[model samples]
Target: MSALQVGLAVAGGLLLGGVIAWETWNARRRAPRQPVPERRPPAPEEGERVEPGVASALPTADDERLEPGFDTAPGALSPLGPVPAPEKRPRLDALIDVIAPIALDGRVVSGDAALAALPATRRVGSKPFAVEGRNVLTEEWEFPIAGQRYDALQAGVQLANRTGPLNEIEYSEYVMKAQHFADALGGAPEFPDMLHEVARARELDEFAATHDAQLSFTLRARLTAWSPGFVHQQAARLGFTAGAIPGRMVLPAEEPGLPPVLGLVFDPRAALSEDPEQSAINSLALSLDVPQVHRNARPFGRLRDVAFALAEVMDGEITDDTGQPLRTEMIDKIGQDLAQLYDTLDAHDLAAGSPQARRLFS
Candidate 1:
């Protein structure tokens, strides 16, 4: 029993104690995880609600409500169940019921009757230069043309009185009247009212006379009596500048007093040729064989169609200061197309006094 024996005995006792503690720790570590929650039995139909783990398996508040505009209740059938083949609306009947009228000027003119039967072109006075068809009555515009503040309706009436079956004479009278009005109003001051009307008239007359055709239609009347200032105002609204329009004037006759009158007509035609919207008007006129002062106006209508289509294409990309896109391309294309179309039209001799001619001439 020396010190070595005593140390070995103490070490054995310590090792045995450590083994017992290790066994206790291992037994605690091996205890089973807590048992998973068991599902409770579903409540009776008339009792408390049961929760579902998956949302799809449970009925929602909306599912229980009845579908609007349907006969079946919700939950009983699909909420959107074969959407009762949309009760078709009586479209034709509705159209007939709420049918609209063809409004001209301030009054309703036609409904179901053929437009041809209705006196579309009517002589206001006994004179041949009468308002035909659906000439819209406009508020009288006062302007200086020759040397007076003249109104187109008044001038038209005067021309009718002065000329009997003399369309040229009547037209001349219009020029004289406009000239007199212009002179009287101080020779092109702030606003020139007869710019479009007089200008268009002179051009049409000259062009028609050259082509051996007669100018006819509400358009003719509108031009003969259009207020240049009013036209400029309208142009401004459409994003064009309101001022003296730049143009190349082409006279109808080589008379002393005729140059200014012809210039009036020529300028508008050139200006209109540059406008995208008005370009189509020219084409439509050609297509319909509508008489125009300037033969050049014929191709403008088609150009306008192209311009409008181009504008539609650009949609939101190009816009003005107020979010309006400058239709520069459309306008340019219109001028180019009109030039080409004019060349083609010019090549083919416009039949003089044919059925196409007679309708306008006669």
Candidate 2:
């Protein structure tokens, strides 16, 4: 071996070693983190058969925080999880605080009297109104006005319209109603120009549009495979009640007054089919009407679990709204987007799923 040959061999060995080290570092950096495994209930013993329609036992309070994983076998519907408490309502911004106030005169007029003077109907066009005391912003009502006797008192009425500005007809109707109420009370009425509030309403509406998002996942069974009855049975076991429309199942909102957050439709139009057998369900859909539902609420996690479980049981694949296959990575990405959206709404004092927001968004 010559000196030059020995030197060249050493240099090549060092270069190869450095290249291998760089590749290893890059691979580790690019690798995804493993998700925490969801806790699941133990399987039934051999020869044991669970009947459909029997409700699963509820989890204890301490176990409420844990989420369940999706299972594929028959009778594996996961129990519903607890809903997290909503974030505190934030103070309303000046823009959102804008109101079209109607003030009436007469100490004789009580809240009931003023309310009676207005149209008997609760809503003017699509905008709902509330009668309040001199202060229209507060929830307090002027009914049973008690105080020192005065020549006249002011009764205020305002609209509950949100997420959109009032149109010309709505504005006209509101002003007319206020004037009519004043006349009935035998006192004059005053109102702010509709255009000013309309402008402000538009700004709030724009903010809502920017933050609003709808999340949906579709499940398609292997072609010509599952029956509609099977889909319905599985969905019922998962806690979805049948909706008004056939083939539609809804998970009722956790908070009674709120709207349902998630819906499952199995071939929505199957009932209209001439041949019942031909209408066998080929695909199922799961969707969340995001703005209508609160984030981190039980429905959010439960819906995801139900979709995954159904996909497993039916030998189906889950896809995005556009029909592209949905992967676990995609689910995480969607979740991150939702968290950011919730933060934005909270910052603006319009937390999604709050009472005020529900009225506005509705």
Candidate 3:
């Protein structure tokens, strides 16, 4: 072969080999094989269930135990229901229980206005009376303290006698009488060796004459010292009224040519032994001829009247039973009424000590 022919023939052979290699490469790329999926384990034989235990998975009685007859379902109530209803509370009696502290066969006492005007006495002291259904009893002074409650009212009276415009002789007589009363009853620890300052006064014919005729001088013995502060005022409000003595040896304060020494006589035993609050409230109702409203009753015109009456009595502005200057020592009674009124207002959320009430004294 010639040199040129040999070179051309070599080139053609390389070209043909290249074309055949390209076709083979293209066919291999287009027809490449895919990977096989993973195989799972073989299924179990028919009716061949695997048993891990012999009924050991079931819950025992202890697992779901509950209270007797108790329902475990959602929102279920227990079989043990509430107890049966208790007996109803008894109703309050109007005649017997309505009177509370005041009762028949009771004595009525009295005191001065300034002596009875302390508001603290009303708050700190006992109710002096309660309306437990209807049976009233005025002997509640020893309620908070064993029989020492009278001392508070007596102290109040003494304070009024000392600071107020009451005369020295009268004040002294009042204190002495109180001391004697306490002594007769056995003196308190505070007033041990207490003497009856009013002994001499009581011995005076005038004292006997002016004192309650139904009660002997010995009854005065039962009477503790009640100047104003030293005793409960409730006793007085429902007890005594200002007026001429009906048939006593003494004349009334309004009586013409009456002795100045014979001040008004206060007899606490005159009224029924009832709660002074209820007594005052009832008496106030009677005084105004109004109905007895509950303590929570509103529109306090009746209460206002009671307050005004009380304030007038306290300020010595209230006329006596006979339309004369109020000479009877009845501030104790007024204070009792006031305490009830205050309690009533408080219970009802009423305004306390209304303007008319204040103006009555002013």
Candidate 4:
């Protein structure tokens, strides 16, 4: 109730209010707050100024296009562009490089005559010897064996492995044979390096590997529809002889030292009926296995003719491996391809179906 007591109470209340306000302000200042994020500049447009060493990291329009014959993966860049593949060589060519030829001269007689006079008992390695011929009137001789005729005068006898290179023993035996032939002909024996010939052979072999092709024509019929005797008769008319196998008939090679190019195959395992009139043939396959280096157009033409004849006689359709009917245009196209191959071989002085080609390609 005293005036001094009332004034003391008011001062106490005022002091309490001021202390509470100060405490609230201190709590708010100590509380944690979220952090602010940083911002980056926008990328420059094409032709715009960019920092040095930074432009190389950016992609260009050409990076999206791929080079020819090149394969690329997604999200990856190839450091080097497409590279060409290396060429392949034949195994025989490398083997022939170490070989040399042993030559025996025929003084007065022809090379062929001297070669033919050689003793049958004499063995000059497993490989056959090739004879080089010269004109009786002129001293010059043909370079290629194909251009020379069988009746040409014999000048020298060469014991070399035209098909493959000779080994140590084989080379020694060939040298011995050359010496013997030289003594018989009363002339000196000479040895020549075959590096040039070996190089030519290699080129021919590579060409063959690139262009080799095989064609087959098949005729299918119901089971027990062709008799073996009838098939043999038909084949005989087409100049086909029974092969080593019972069901196989092969066309004879046009020249000696060459293998058969075409063959007729029949299924001999088919059931046979007791009736003589019934047929026992199942299927017939006509195949032309042409040599890559020595093939000519004649073989392909003959093959087509024989296929047509057999198809007509058997009352069957000619088809490919996929059983699709073969059209005449397809066969004509094959013939054209064969002609082109022959021309290419001839241009390189390696005529197809020639004796030299046969010997080298063998």
Candidate of highest lDDT: 2
lDDT string, candidate 2, 1-362, tens digits: 99999999999999999999999987654332222234566887999996667445333223422235533222222253343344343222233443333433434445555555656764556766433344233433343233412234333222334435556677677667656656776776556666776666666667766777767789986533555566666676565778899778887765455567678876666745675444556677898877667664544466677777767656688897677898877886887778788788878766676655665666
**How big is the positional error of residue 15 in model 4, measured in Å on the Cα after superposition?**
99
Comparing 2 with 4 on lDDT, the higher-scoring candidate is 2
Cα RMSDs, all models = 33.2, 16.7, 40.1, 33.5
Candidate 1 per-residue C-alpha lDDT over 33-97 given as tens digits, one digit per residue, 9 for 90 to 100: 22223355566598667666642211223432212222111112223222111112111111001
Local distance difference test, each candidate: 0.29, 0.59, 0.28, 0.52
Task: List where candidate 2 sits over 4 angstroms from the true fold.
Answer: 1-115, 124-126, 133-139, 142-164, 272-278
The candidates, ranked best first by TM-score, are 2, 4, 1, 3
Candidate 3, superposed: residue stretches over 4 Å from native: 1-155, 158-164, 189-362
lDDT of 3 at 106: 35
Per-candidate TM-scores read: 0.17, 0.65, 0.16, 0.48
lDDT over C-alpha atoms for residue 234 of model 1: 24
